[model samples]
Target: MTKTVRIALQGLTCDGCVSSLTTAFMTNPAVESVTVTREPSQATVTYNSAETTPEALCSLVDDAGFEGTVSES
Candidate 1:
């Protein structure tokens, strides 16, 4: 089964930052889709729990150059 993760991001200054995270998350095998909004500083991430976890998802965001934290919604 798949699981959805919602993340609140910090330090997203521009579209380029959102795009970078979008690219990184989309390339992940476990992630089915992603939506990031810079104005609200949030991202809705859908992924397979079997292949990944919230921690890993946040790591991708961190690697992409933004601060990320997960929350339930």
Candidate 2:
């Protein structure tokens, strides 16, 4: 199934952060799309649930040198 995850982010300082994160998420085969917004410090990601999980997605953000937590909203 396809799932959409909204993640609250920390440590994003500029447009470059958005670019880097967007690139990172786009590299994942499981990720269908990614929309990162800096003003609100969040990312809306769509991915295949069978191929990845919300935890793994947060880990990916961490690996990219940022912090992320699954957002309820």
- For every model shown, what is its TM-score relative to the native structure? 0.93, 0.98
What are the per-residue Cα lDDT tens digits for candidate 1 across 1-73? 7988899999889888888889989989999999999878989999999999999999988888788999768
Model 2: worst 10 consecutive residues (lDDT sum): 21-30
- lDDT, model 2: 0.97
Off by over 4 Å in 2: none
After best superposition, candidate 1 residue 14: deviation in angstroms?
0.8
Looking at model 1, the pairs that clash are none
lDDT (CA) per prediction: 0.90, 0.97
Give lDDT tens digits, candidate 2, residues 1-73. 9999999999999999999999999989999999999989999999999999999999999999999999997
Q: Pick the candidate with the highest TM-score.
A: 2
